[model samples]
Structures are given as C-alpha cells and as structure tokens.
Target chain A: MRRIVTLLLALVCLAACTKSAGSDALVVGTEAAFPPFESVATDGSLEGFDIDLMRAFGAHINREVTFSSRDFSALIPDLQAGRIDAIASGMSRTKERAHVVLFSRPYARVATGVLVSTQRVADAAGLEALEGDDVVIAVQRKTTGEEKAETRFPNAQIRVYDREVDAAAEVAAGRAHALVYDMVSIVNLHAQHPETTRIIDTELGIELYAVALPLGSELAPALDAFLAAETRPGGKVDELLAKWLGDAERFRATEE
Target chain B: MTAQRERLVRGAVVMAIIAALAIVISLAPGEIRWALAWERRDLFLTGLGLTVVISSGAVGIGLILGVIAALFRVSRSVALDQIGRTYVEVVRGTPFLVQLYLWYWCIAQALQLHGLFGPREAAIVGAIGLGVFGGAYIAEVVRGAIESIDRGQWEAARSLGLSHAQALRHVVLPQCARRLLPPLTGEAVSIVKESSLLSIIGVAEITYHAKNLQAREYETWAAFICLAALYLVVTLPLTLLTRRMERRLAGEEALPVARL
Candidate 1:
C-alpha cells in the first residue's frame, strides 16, 4: 500500500510541475452565435464586428489573440476563471455586470426591440402592450434584453434561450408571443425570415456595448487605453461600424 | 529498515511532496488564489445545495428503476426480458447530454404545450432524465450482483419451501448486498458528477454557480479549485462509507491477523 501511494504521489507531482509552463497568448471569450456582432461562418470560423475589433486590439498589443466561443451567460465566468483574458462579445455595460467585471469605453450603442410574428405585430404595439399574464416572452439568457424583459413585463411569462436565434425562432413559430433582443439582431432575423417575423417599433432602451475584462485585471488599463484610441474619430471603430452595420442608416446613427 | 520506520518514512515523504507542490502553486505569478473563493462562499453553498438535491433525487429514482429493470432482466418471461434489455441497451448507448436535451427541450416543450408544466420544471425533468440514464447502468450492476451468487443458494431456499420472491428477499438479496455495495457506491459517485451537466439547462448546480462566480470575479483558478473541493466533500465520505461497509460485512476476516 505504501509503495502504491508513493508512486501515485510522484505521478501527481510530475503532473503539477509540468502544468506551470504558461503561454503569452491573450484568450478572448465570445458567443459566436450573435450575428452582426459575432457569429460562426460556413467555414466554422468566427467572424463579425467584435472579432475584427478584437483582432485589431490584439495586433495593437502585439499579443496573439485566441478566441473561445462559449454561451453568452458563461462568458463572465470564463473570464473570472482566467479561462479567457477578456470578453469581446457584444456585452452591454449594465450596473449589475459592472459590479463584477470592468468594462472598457463604449465602442458602440445598440437599441433593444421586440420581435413578434406578423399577426401579433399590431397587438404588440409597444413594450407596454406586451405586458400581461397571457403573453409569453422569449429572450436570450444573460443578455440585457432578457433583464429588461423581466423587469419591464413582470406579468409576462419569460422563456430564456441559450441562443438569440432560438429566441427569435420561438416567436416565429408562434409558440412565443414575442422575442426581446437587440434591434440589429431582430432586424437581421426579420430580413432573413420576412414572412414569419416583424420588429415592433417600440424601443426598449438604448445600451452601450463594451468589452469586459476581469475586475482589477492587469490587462484592464491596457484594454481601456486601446479602446479609447480605437473609438476615436476615423479610427478602427469607425471602420468596423461602416463595414458591418453601415448598410442601414439607423444602425450607423446609433454608433458611438 | 524496520517495517514501522519504513512506513513512517514513506508517509512523511508523501506529505512533504504535497506541501512543496502547495508552496510552488502559491508562489507562482498569475496562479489561482484560493482565498478569492471565500468571498463568494454563499454562492458556492447554494450551488452545492442544488447539486446535492439533484444527485440524491436522481440516485433514489435510479435505484428504484434499477430494481424493476433487474427483476425484468432476471425474469423467466422472454417479453419482459427483452423489454429490460432494450431499455438498458438504448439508454446506455446514447450520450447523456443528448438525453438531457431530449428531456429539457423536446419533452418539456411538449409538456408546456399541453399546459402540464412550464419551463421552470426543466430541473425536475433533468433530475428524472439523469435518473433514467443512471437506471440503465444500475440495472446491469444489480443483475451482475444477483447472478454472482452460487446457484445452490437458490436451490437451498427452494428446498426450504420459500417462494421465489421470499427466497430473493430473505436469502439471495441479503448476500448480494455485500457484493453490490462497492459498485452501487461507484454508480452514486458517477451520478453526482454527471449532475454538473444539469447546469447547461440552467439548473444552477455547483458548476453553474462556479461559472457564475468566475464570470463575476474573474478568479478562474480559485473558483474551480473550490468547485473540486466541494465535489470531494460529497464523494469522499461516500467512498469511505463504502470501505467501512465492505469491511463490516467481511466480519472477523477483515481484522488483521496476528503475526506468528
């Protein structure tokens, strides 16, 4: 027994000693399912405004940026665990999240909107009209839109989904009364499935999107500085905004 | 090189090596600071509580289903045996995550459509799903334990005028308990570990809370180490209990023999 225990102890020590060799790459976490911001393409590569911006930031810092796609709700936990050095998902700067993570300067602004089946679009008139026990609201889990839906429509039954597209599909199938999400995502979904869904004109609220870093992280100052320089007039932020959302004047007007 | 001194030296060396590793990890820059988990202890406690609840509920359900499936497996009827075999085969063949989604997304969605339940019931569905999955494996453990007994034991009970059920309950099962304890404990541990998957469907178990804390604090190493320690608290006691039960069942044979 003693010999076996000694052998196991030696093996454990060897494992622990080998694991301490670390790397210099900056790991960034994102949910690559949210489009016009970040999404997976046909070739299984991550692409979007956030991906481009993060790659640019990585180049500026002279560190290789590695992206890890995870569920949006999981991004903060991954960041906290040091699984990822930063979050470049289209996360909004909210008071609740700010308590846990440090947010860089707002890179862009987005409006929250409701998407409903065309038949219910007239009934959905606005956020106020959708608040009732009979209404079922679908929102992506851990997103600003879900938080807003929960607080604003307290009576409505809220269903949280893992993906934005899933939430939109619930409304498209008429199983859900509406989906509360960012305007750009809802608009894009509506454009793709025009016959099935429509975006309600009622504006939930405007939110500023920013990158999230660990609280008191050593990288926080450097990230904030980079973001400040990038968001300046005629900087990388403008170029990205033009490339991704410029086709629509409304989206361009919302850019920070 | 006395045996007693040799054992003491071995124990001391293991402890010294462990202490060295602890120091190295603590001194390393950017290493996980375990103290960070202390700040979010309440969150972890909540997660631990949910994990225990889900695991216990699933294990209890699994044990009951296991007995039924085992009975079918050992029964004389071909149809019943086939039913048991198919259930165990199919459930054991598929991935657990797929089964969890089937229960949470498909079955739960259908339940909601019929107004039988709502989305919040996914945790209950998840527990039951885990139980059903575990039952398939547990069924095999039980069948193996029962079959491992000598054939003459059943014949001896029959000669004493006991019915099949009475023979099983009073004669066969009592003996099988000793053989079954170790593997049953192993199954229990697996069920507890698998409960972490419940987090994907939003069960808010230990892994979920760990992720939440990590996301909130960005202290990845601290959160995971704490998570591992919490799981150990559940599994370690079970392992010790199994050993104790095994020794107790072994009777005087388990006692150390006197050196001649």
Candidate 2:
C-alpha cells in the first residue's frame, strides 16, 4: 500500500533525525566589537584581520567556515559547548586560559600602552609617571591591560568599562585621566580621534594573540599548522598586518 | 470530591507531570544533559539571587514612581500632566538597553562631573535604569486600573464629603489594587527577564554567570537549560500566585481547570 510505504519512509527520516549528523563545516565564533581584529560593518557584514585569516585558513583546510558573532565573554563558552568549532577573536594566549581551551600558534605580537587626553597632560614619560592617587585610569573589563594597569599603578583609581571604545571615550571626554589598552587599539583610537586623544609613549608589556579551540580538539593542530605556514616570512600574516596596521615595521619590530 | 480536595489533587498531578518530564529529559542521552547544570548549581544560584535582588529593587522603586506619575497624569494642572505624559512617552519609546547605556555611560559621566557618583559602580545605575523604564509601563497600568473603576465611586466619595486625595486613597485605590495585581505581577516578571541586560555592563547576574560557566565549561546547551530552569523557578511561583489571587478576587469556587 502507498500509505504503508509513506509511513515507513517517515519512520526512516525520524530515525535519521535522532542521530547527530556529522558535518565538515567549521563554525567560527568571534566578538566583532574589536576593530581591525573582528568587527561588524554597518551593512552587517564581518570585516577584519581575524575574519580574513579564518577564511584563508578554512580554504587551506578545505572546510566551509561559518562565522558567528557573540559577546567577547561568551565566545569561549560557545566553543567549549560545541556550539562553535573555534574562536578567531583577538584573544591573547595566557596560562590560565590554556587550562580550559587549546590555543593556536601566536599570530601577532602587540604591546600594551596608555592613551591620555592631549590637553590634560603635555607629555608622559612612562607608566610610573602616570601612577598616582589623583589620576584615574580607564581599562576594558577582563583584559590583560586592566590587570597590568591594576598592578602597575596601584595608587591610581581604575575604572573598568565593557568596551574598549568606551574606555577610550572616557579618556577623550576628559572624564578619565588615561586609558590603558593594547597599543594597536590605542593607535587606532588615536587615529580616529587625533585631536582629543594621544597614545602615551609607554610600553607596558608584550602579549601574543591566538585562535582559541576546545581542549583536545582535532581542529587545534590543524589551525596551528595553518598559522605556522601562513605567518612565515612574507606570508599571509604579513599581508594582513600591512593591510590593517598600515605600518608593518612597528608590528615586525616586536616579532623576535 | 470537595472543591479544596479537588484543587489539591490537580496541583499534585501537574507537579508530577513536570517531574516526570524533567526526569526523562535528564536521563535521556542527548545534547542537553540537565546533570551538567546540576553540578554548577552554586554559580547559577548566586546569579539567580542577584537577579531577584535587582528586579525586586527595581520593582519597589517603580511602584513609588508609578503612583506619583499616575497622580500627575490625572491631575487638574496642565503642566504637571504634560510632564508626566512626556516622561512616560520618552521612556517607553526608547529601548531599555539604550536607556541603560545612556544612564551608565552618558548620564553617569555627567553625574561624575558633579562628584555625585562614579561610572565604575554600574550595578546601582542599572537598577535605577530598570526602575525608570518599568515606571513608565507601571504608570499606564495604574492609570488604566484607576480609570476602570466607575465614576460613580468618585461621586459617591465626594458626596460623603471626602476630598479628592482622601477619596483616591480610601475609596478608589483599594478597588484598583485588585485590578492592578495581575498586570503588576507580569511587569515584575518582565523586570526579572530584563535584568539580564544588566549583564552587558557586567552586573554578575544569572545570565552573566551562565555565560561565564559556558565559556569556562564550553557547555552551551546545558548552561542555557540551567539558566532557563533557574528563571522558571523564580517566575513560576509568581504566575501561580497571580492566578490564585485572580480566582479568589473573582469569588469563584476552588475548582481546578481540567487538563488535557
């Protein structure tokens, strides 16, 4: 009977649906708020160094990479839950984070610095000069820059902001005395608001950015291999740095 | 069966159904294992407590502001009524998240210039933001409930030589309270859900803690399921209580509605 055959077909489809279908597509999670790393444009398209790198890596690995934007704090959890295959946000590799998720090879090195209002302070020597009870520093929450600012300037009142732009804006608006963040982001902010803000010539410390993966994930080794080949002399990484950073010499200087 | 006995039986059956479904979902080998969430109960509980505290604080503030705004809205004075109407329209028109940011980032900055508050303490600002936002909706509810009462009640109170304030306080508001209860409960639930937005500014509420667990454990399904269950625990009781209150106020027999 046609009805019996139809019932049999329906049961077969239901059975197939119950079992998880394995796919080769890679779901990459990113916090698109960090510009030049991963940022969403006005048209809702993702554009940044991290986006391009992931697409290039996906091509190298022969997998269809799908990107999902999430809160910066939620990216790792989404990855661990298998909701995402990997993270391509500009996340720095640290010992504490390595306990939970595997990290790919370091893609780029960046120094932390302070951004101060040009009108407020004429010249700043280093991190110590800016340290005092009266000076209030703004830093993005859950960042190494925040940690560094806390330790380096214990006397200074620290204001933690959810977004790097907000922290920079506080300094620009003259509410906060200075903003502590990665040098690349500070430079970008200064470029955008040159008259209001200036990057203080203080090198806090160097940190390396890498892709985060779930622990014991098969994708980890593959991403690491791709990063190794692509970041070699005059490779894809150099191309990205030139395109986004504008001056490859500054990023290259800290390479060694 | 007696009406009270029947209601008790119905309540038991519903609870049993919920329990059986929970057991089946937890024991089933699938993407969402409730056990994963059960293990992180402490973290979730802390988040829930914070959520309740923030929402209740907002609700408390909202009630006072709502009453004042409603009074102003129905007042004889044109200026006061216009001010009240504008406050409700402006607040209700904007998204809560934008209002939150406006309070946290812009207004907080302005306040800091006057040395009144610090921008770093965002939780207080978030509670105040939720309160101000909820007050607009609550004002409408209060006005509607007050207006729903017959104009005869007001005239009767005036004939009894009661002033407008005395009549509103003694005669009309008591009637409005019963009509207001269900919607006020709904507003309270919404306030609890909206408290999740506070997590954006890092308030360490339930959603924020859930994200922390998800990020750390990498179990999104389990983390979110737990989050949903925790919220249900907070909201379900209020919903049942509201239903019971509505039934009691209606003077209906204590008969349970039949289930499928």
Reference interface contacts recovered per candidate? 0.00, 0.00
For B202-257, candidate 2 gives per-residue lDDT tens digits of 56678876665543333456777778888999999998888888878676323452
Please report, as a residue range, the 10-residue window in candidate 1 chain A with the lowest summed lDDT: A247-256
Alpha-carbon error at B153 in model 2, in Å?
16
iRMS per model, in Å, is: 18.8, 20.6
lDDT of 1 by residue, B105-177 (tens): 6775555521222222546777889999999999999999899877888998989999888888888887777
What do the candidate models score in CA lDDT, each in turn?
A: 0.78, 0.77
Best by lDDT: 1
Provide backbone clash counts, one per model.
6, 4
Model 1 residue B202 lDDT score: 52
Could you give candidate 1's fraction of true interface contacts?
0.00
lDDT of 1 at B55: 88
TM-score of chain A in every predicted structure: 0.88, 0.85
DockQ of each: 0.02, 0.02
| Candidate 1 per-residue C-alpha lDDT over A101-219 given as tens digits, one digit per residue, 9 for 90 to 100 | 99888888889988887666565466666888989999999999999999989999999988776677678768888898998888887775577777788788998899999998887
